[model samples]
Target: MTVYKTYTIGVTITGAANGIGPILQNNLGDDLFIPAITTGLTSFTFSTPVLDGAAYSVTQRIRAKAPSQDCSSITPVSGTVNGADVTVSITCVLSTVVPKFAFVTNSAADTVSAFNIDGVSGNLTAATPTPTTASGAVPSAVFVDPTGQFAYVTNKDANSVTVYGINPDSGVLTVIDADGATADFQPSIATGYAPMSIAVHPSGKFAYVANELNLAGGNSISAYSINITSGALTAIDADGATDGNQASIATGVEPYAITIDPLGKFAYVANYASYNVSAYTIDQITGALTPVADSPFAAGSNTHSIVIDPTGKYAYAANGGGDISAYSIGGAGALTQIVCANGVLTTCSGSNYVAGSAPRSIAVDPYTGLYAYVANSGGGVSAFGIDPATGALSAIDADAATPGDNLTIAAGSVPISINVDPSGQFVYVANLFSDNISVYSIGVGGALTPLPTLSLSTGSGPTSVTTTQ
Candidate 1:
């Protein structure tokens, strides 16, 4: 005989404004409220119906109107009521707008703040800072291991990678390794120049870093073997053998971003200076890379970012010169550019689909592989509906609305990076010039609508945003 088991996932909602707070209270059956709207002095609680044998994780998200104020001081009180287990918490108190999981500014003197998310209460609490020695002048992109035992951060300015041991109970970080001194064992011990991005393979056996150095003959990619037990990096191939030659294999220019295929058998790099992308075949045994056949596919002018769709059938690139191009990836890693109805490049061949000046980044919605978003530095984001069969793009709703639609939102001057949450329910844009984050809700039909905007703390230049599990 086989026994059946089930688990329950719960969610709670909160707000920073008076009108929305009351509306949320009325919509949710069990809810709580703080007496005043005063900054750094508000508290609230809410509960979900008792769910027996339900296994779930709780997270708290905040929607604030102001960007500079800190929301970390608020605390939550959550526990079991009757026989039901629950939790309460507060949200991240940031001076600038932070994407759900993107790297925020952190330094030895100024550590990025942490928060405790309550699965039961739908709240967050300020967490103690994990110690570090590197100057926090640059922000660190955060990536967690598959086993949840450790976390890794790529510090841009520090030109170093930091490892942290995760607390199982609270999901907070504790510094374990500050530099590559004790990375997982491989070969080389030297660090890559100006490491800007880090991605851990889906297998949890290796990690790759994208060095954004532009100095003559200085830029390249780095590979490492992951220490399963220690969560440290062990350099693999030295002499930059697998490093994409510090230029795009196709365009022969500087590379900026890197991503591995979902199958873990291949990798792709975005060539910032070459206006193209390079593909490489990965050695399953050693995690080393070799250029794929017919690689260095022409992407677009100043191609700086690339993302493979969830299905891995198509690849998209954000052309910094002002457009987004799509390509159909052949089974052998070859790229075939998709042509528009008018027989021109589908990315920006028409007036309606023309992207704003200087498109910086692109992110796809996980739930529906048919939708994608582009962050245009000229201001606002561009929404596109992907043609599944052709890998073509058709703009949705005429560029959508700018950062501020409902009520004059102060989006940092130049919007640089845009990311969609794992759930595909929200989209966050990082504005470099304005130093703010713009939030938007994704509609059922793949359209983007604006949400409340928030500013970062003083001196925080928001760059990239990612979500953590």
Candidate 2:
């Protein structure tokens, strides 16, 4: 002679329409949750029940007519029934992440090509709102801010930085001035002479540009503070904002490329004619640069561009004279050469790897930093595996015959600017002579698989390419 009883679970959902009825899952399905209030139901319970003292769990798998939201959190998710019922609450919020985008600066056509990167297929399609946006004269390089709110382009002939406001929903570009309209400051924010490359800080509060030529000094770097509310650039003082000789921070001849470390603590520039690299520490709050002690570090001849690895532990300089200069970054942001017995990358001669005919730019994998990619103005892109400990590099075995000896991946005629996407999924090269872009998916073991069909068409002469964060 015994008496038995059963207990049910209640699911209370908030922040959604009251009439929104959905079945709860995970041992609590089979019953429709009407929720509380104006449905006029004070206390409603699920139909399925466990025997008194049995265990139960509630999951956030809403079965019907639910908005796209995450409901992984369920209160009182699992427990044993103690002769009483249990209730779980759920709250829904919408997602804000927009689509990914890629930008290309066309030096010949004076326009920037914009495209949407497909997340599933890793393909580039023309972005909505438009295909290309007008830029200043001879646009050399493009950089998207960390917040994905704006894009800055360096116009070599225009000697200015063009600002474009990125459309959050469509990934389109609209010239943004101080007031978000008119061409007063929207078209060009005057910088130094022949602006070549642009880089933004990790905080998205500042941006810097490399000036290849100037009368104030041989070459200089221009710094600016970004407006938070509106995507505008204001030149910072003592960095050639007003063209004062005393205010300019001079660099070696023809500073062609600039980059900031992942932590936003340091900045480095490659001077083409100087045959060296300049290092500086960034002012976190003010965004100003102070030269590191033993400032200019030696690089290979005719250094065109420099890149700091994702880990911020090493740096590589791409020289137009057909070699890559590798270095280990010191604690104070100084560079020390990684010497190797042999000059070419036939093996892991760490110091300088014999690049293709004319190496224009170099980039390393973002996450592991295990691989490096180079764009050759001579012909194609070269792939190399990075030695993790010594920052040494050797060519990827494309043919499996001449391991670490020859380059196999072919690109456009003058592939100048090369970059790996932030996710480390793909590599993009701006072909200056071919007037197009070459696309490749990073395969296993840091090899490259060219996707000619997915390749993108650009304006006349594409000098630089970059992607949104």
Candidate 3:
């Protein structure tokens, strides 16, 4: 059956005269142009034939010259099409600001939850329609770009990375639809099986994922070049396929997590089964990975997570054996285990702070670069004060000199992942077994005081937490 719909798209220019631009439809090409709107509003009628029950989108744009003679976006930028005749009204406003957001991945529910951080209290408020489908199975890790415009989630069960376009103002995640003109068709990009972790470079040009299960090669890491303007990812391969045809780079056994340094010069992977950290130098222009000298450096037994300091001078690894390993990073991205006399880094003369049962995630303070936190699966979080000169780790609680004084603070059951906000004032933890998130406020000397609540309820089995503010 042939279906036809007649729709009028209305464009209104509030302040400008004779605004010029194009009106775009998702499936249809740019077939109409905005006439001179000397008055406030103008309407154009078109009788388009489309398949019944098909979805389309309509948006409007206008050209202005205050900043430059470029097309400025007017909202509501896109309108929903349901194969029915409808009118879309767009008001062109000049100023709009993007807001900060925090995201958590619910592993068992296979969803992603978003929240807005309270500016003054550092509390998280659930976004309207809080949880959104993560678009893949077992969303294990999530990372937001430095530009704050896009987010990527690694799905362990589905072996794909779901790309989401972040709503600038409302702090929501929407999967990019199958519209090349408006959005991209690649909402979820294929990756190696059992992808565990994701890391975006500080330059915002590259992203890497640690695949836990070996596909064709041994356990591998996937590299991708990020599109700056659109936030789309293109796989980098030597064969030159436009799509993601790059073969995954081999890594140590059971690569659990990956991280990039602040300078964007190197990448690191923590191998759980191999008990080592793999270091690689990242090519600036091409985003290729080259192993550094003695790339798989020895770390604690069953190291699971790694994080680099903001200064790029040191790195830390959390191990399953309830210890955090310290290392001094070289200029060429080599890892040197800090000489420990008695489990201590032995520079300022301190021992490795013993954390909860199994440490899974580690986070560093971005601003001061002196504080670090780890989420221990046993039941709580471990806080530490990092020595800037010798790259040593020290517990922050009262008994600083005592060995195994992890300065542990209570959290919900099975705290699997943790993070600190940009201001360094608050900390968030994702509790897997309890399906809740614990909030804490950082105090003097990295002391954590839990907020007066049990915890924030989340979807099923919240496994990871990340924030941008």
Candidate 4:
């Protein structure tokens, strides 16, 4: 017996010129409908045919308006279409959801390259071939805050930090001055000397900079309280006192790198000249750092970078002496070197893990914390498989011959910095000498493959890279 009776789910959209939707019916499901409206008019209506007595659900597929605008479905959107045509309502409003941008620092050009990143595919769309904003002299490193609201850059020669307000819609960066002064002439905040890298606490309430040298005496960490509203920086009133710089936290000689744990409880610094790691406990409210017990823990020679895992369980340091130093995070944020012997496949082992020459930087996959990548200034990136339980690292595959055979990936000259996209689907490497960025798509079992043309053009001397997603 054939009973051909049908009804439709109608959607009326307000505040938009056109509306397109997907209306799913119980038997004949997943039909596309385009609601049409004349130009300059904001009201529209559309419907798709549905079978009689079939359950239906409707969702907005496209809302023709600014990217920031949003549309939501009203109640009665899903029901059994019995006889007559069913009508539902959709309301359009202004909603902003901007994400996925990449920032790169050019040390020689004194500018930062800004690229808009696609959330689905990690491809980059450059706003300009050249950088749009001018940073301070010798901008060595660039870091984006956790909230993706602002970007901070370190100027080695300028002895300051360049703060930029990130445009939510386009990912364009604009220099921001907290004091309402000129951004081109003066930096947003002053530091001791030669700030190497910057890291913001997990709470997003404070920020710290690793100054390689203090004008007066010992190295210091510049401490600042972050303004939640405007993304501005204000120096914290707290001081390091005896050995600290003026209103800043003090460390050993030439602090080259700094990172806060995922929990926002502890902070760590890698002192390059001192060849050790400095540990500190963060005063959550005051944004102050105090020395942890047995501070200045031993690491490989010439430590250049340090990073804590997303779980806040393990830490890794990239040493210039050609090896990675791994540690387990103690209760108070101190690092204890793990001694996992060879042959432990998944277990953690930081002991005697040799890397390529001049391993300058290291980073863990924040999304999974399952892999780590090292930026070797010698022209390739070393990939490591992180042990989940022990929080140590192991080489991905020792059997593969030559780099790019699945063991390691090749990069351009002087790959000074490396970063993983927020989605953990891609990797970005900044080649300082070659002035290019190498792109790689991560594969199964923690392997990397070239995404496309291998590398993208960058500024004069791209030194640092970071991402938002």
Best by lDDT: 2
- Candidate 3, which segments miss by more than 4 Å at Cα? 1-99, 177-184, 214-218, 238-246, 341-353, 398-406
Least accurate 10 contiguous residues by lDDT in model 3? 61-70
Collision pairs in model 4: none
Task: Residues 1-469, candidate 2: write the lDDT tens digits.
Answer: 7878887777665443222333345454442433222223344566777788887776643321212233346454677888887776655443222238889999999999888887545578887769899998999999987657889888889888888889877778887772233446557877788889989876567888888974553398888887755778877653422334332467888999999976677899999998899988887766778888898998878899999886677899999988888889988898998764453545332367787878999988764588889998998788888887888777774323234545757788789999887667678888998888888878787777777543478889999988754
Candidate with the larger TM-score of 1 and 3: 3
Cα error, residue 306 of model 2, in Å, equals 0.6
CA RMSD of all predictions: 14.2, 14.3, 13.1, 14.4
lDDT (Cα) of model 4? 0.74
Better by lDDT, candidate 3 or 1: 3
Each prediction's whole-model lDDT (CA):
0.56, 0.75, 0.72, 0.74
Candidate 1: C-alpha RMSD to true structure equals 14.2
> What does the lDDT read for residue 64 in candidate 1?
24
lDDT by residue for model 1 (122-188), tens: 1234344542223233654555664457666666666666667767655556667433445354222
TM-score of 1: 0.65
Model 2: ten consecutive residues of lowest lDDT? 62-71
**Each candidate's TM vs. the true structure?**
0.65, 0.74, 0.73, 0.74
- Model 4 Cα lDDT, one tens digit per residue, 159-190: 78888988877778889774223344445678
Clashing pairs in 3: 344-351
